[model samples]
Target: MLDANLKAQLQTYLQKVTQPFEIVASLDNSAKSTELKSLLEEIASLSDKITLKLDGKDERKPSFALNRIGENMGVVFAGIPMGHEFTSLVLALLQVGGHPSKLAQEMIEQIQGLDGRYEFETYFSLSCQNCPDVVQALNLMAVLNPNIRHVAIDGALFQEEVEQRQVMSVPMVFLNGEMFGQGRMGVEEIVARLDTGSADRAAEKMNEQAPFEVLVVGGGPAGSAAAIYSARKGIRTGVAAERFGGQVMDTLSIENFISVKETEGPKLARAMEEHVREYGVDIMNLQRASKLIPAAEQGGLHTVEFESGGKLQAKTVILATGARWREMNVPGEQEYRTKGVAYCPHCDGPLFKGKRVAVIGGGNSGVEAAIDLAGIVAEVTLIEFDTRLRADEVLQKKLNSLANVKVIKNALTTEVKGDGSKVTALVYKDRATEELHTIELEGIFVQIGLLPNSEWLKDTVALSNRGEIEIDARGATSVPGVFAAGDVTTVPYKQIIISMGDGAKASLSAFDHIIRNS
Candidate 1:
């Protein structure tokens, strides 16, 4: 189960273990259990401080617990931790063996100080790129606070539990057997949810801050670039993002980023964040902007209101809020979301293995999803509203070659049919024949495109009919001293490189306005 190169790396990582720990595994005579045992034995062979025990009795077989010597830290992995979760396993071992985490000191203290019992069960897939963050975050928290226990279960391995819970997405978290959240979430966001007073405290702290020379709203590539460029000018810069990394975090693979051969979304987002942190920009994460109030006077500070009731003032505001996945908005869609309807093929595709699924849209994303799902799912129905698929020739050809995939063009998704607990079928209308068709499927993946997150600026700034913030070449919006960039604005192409360039241009334009007005 363990390769030579991987074993050597694991041995190197285990050298940092300062204390003794044991792997308590619950196993049966299953193939996965045997594989898991082999992996655990290889890990234990690397370090003398590590011990493996197969005498455990957990209802979830093929599961294991990384417990500190004589202490039950309550961190469990129900399936073999490979693929994306392999890093999570390594980190758990080191942290449980007394190695320190790289988490901020402030956050460490917050996790340790958090009161009440939090029994978190996060269901994830091995192929999912976003599951590690949530698993590692919760594992770290469990290691820090005894009251907080986390069990990262592989949904594929625990299909019964997943079906009973009506989970159709990766990284679906349940707290005390109740649904906590779904999708990507960081430690800060998790802590904020558990500690209700954190919001009030954060809001109060924001109220005491001085007005920034450049305040960037959103923390995608655009916001990060804008912040870095503005901070390089030696001005007071700040960035308040609802969730730093934005849509980029949801992206699975980024091949056309330019220069870089290949990279994943979360990895690129981390690098961008670290680059921005090198500057003097004050970044406020998990801060949602509810409204934008322009400055009363020409040289006055503009106020950006937050959903948490926190407000921040800035001389010039750069909107880089980016975009979110466009929804089908058809009947039963919202009701079946996570019950069977999902947007991300990379994240939620594994849950539909051996099942029939539908991919809405015929663009690159839709075609790509159909191709990817063809390998895992029993069948993939690619439905396109356009007369033909708009994907690249190569992708369309590849999708057409797939035996398990079917393409239906000029079909408009009308309604998502579900059995109250999960999706059962999808309804669509044929544009040419004006006939309604229903395709029975277990899941629906919406991959149409993105919608700009510019609803808050609809009333304050000049917006296009499509709700994008209107901006000129200088990135200046209709409101003086206010600028927009990236997907939120009326930009032509919503590429990462283009967004970064737009961000830098907006920052420079904002600086020019500031100097002239001053």
Candidate 2:
């Protein structure tokens, strides 16, 4: 309970609030019986400055609260605000605060004039801290445009809703109830979509579509493999993707893939795409599948709809969108991407040979990269934001034994330092000492983690609590005619070879299903 002094302090703070603000407390009877009532009374004394509403019967029945708040100032989520979710809550608050002078008034005026409702829905797992920027960007847009409403659904909390929506990836954004884009998009691009009313059109277009024999939802390795294998078996195959390569395009080299010791991700994607194309598989690029509708009858064809006013019918679907590198979301990180910052060690580690480099993350990937880079680079600095490295004991021992590798514990990356063209150094804060330091490095490998691309399919397929698409041994999902593959699926290993194997297996299963149906 808040002390009298604290309550008085809160009252003083409430008096300062010139704008209209509401405190719709969704606490249980226990809270209402105690400090909650007192707080409400204290707040009500402020008159029009703040409105206090208490719902003691049902705490969770605030379905309309979010909508009601959408019409007013920003909301403040009072909680620990820890982990990946804190960033989202912060962005939401910023949205409620409304647009500041940061954005051009001209653009703000244009946005204010828009009357249509814009709802932006993002589905993400609790582990996906990398998606904060996506939320923040949407919040900014929503603040700038009063007509826009942003909602983030926790994948774990809304499992059934996600499965029905066919969300198979995290950080999947739906504008106006239709998926506008996946992965990440810039503010400018998002604004353009909203201005042109393309966002709303996408939602309406997805509501109408038919089913196909096999619907491959990505153009990456796993998706391409599924397409090629299904087409070769003479099954009607269709592939839809927002981009051609998925995460494979981010890779600079592929040394571990069997029979291809050294190949760029783009090259591999092109080859895979070519093979699928030769097999006469229907390929759609720059197109995003907004939703998946299951057949009313068992074993019936499923409907896969796209955002581009087109739809495809499919009996089976393969999800192979893969995963994305977890970003730091610190300042200047995006501006220095490809200039000095990189995610794939195997892709960019070689470029820093004989030079200093820092690897952010203490997992197996980071340890492995540090160990690998120690042999090639003059020095390897491994910065672990946590108190201890999370990698296996053997990997940690190996990292410790490496003379060229220096481990920095409890260090958080605060900023990325670089010129407009490239990166020169990185700035970090020591958690324990509260001191800041700078490290000169030719390359910064962001091996923090990987997030599955499965938010869009949440309403269509079952996903693990971690946000990976759930699949069986044959790559079949809980929903019939919907299979999944690659890192996006709930496979134990996230290796390229494993993803390819899953794709091949899923393709075979899809083909078998098609044949039986025929």
Q: Name the best candidate (by lDDT).
A: 1
Off by over 4 Å in 1: 297-299
The top-ranked prediction according to TM-score is 1
Error of 2 at 368 (Å): 4.9
User: What TM-score fits each model?
Assistant: 0.98, 0.51
- Candidate 1 C-alpha error for residue 438, in Å: 1.5
Error of 1 at 68 (Å): 0.9
When summed lDDT is taken over every stretch of 10 residues in candidate 1, the lowest stretch is 292-301
lDDT of each structure? Answer: 0.93, 0.68
> Candidate 1's error at 203, in angstroms?
0.9
For model 1, name the residue pairs that clash: none
Q: What is the TM-score (0 to 1) of candidate 1?
A: 0.98
Lowest summed lDDT over 10 consecutive residues: which window, candidate 2?
59-68
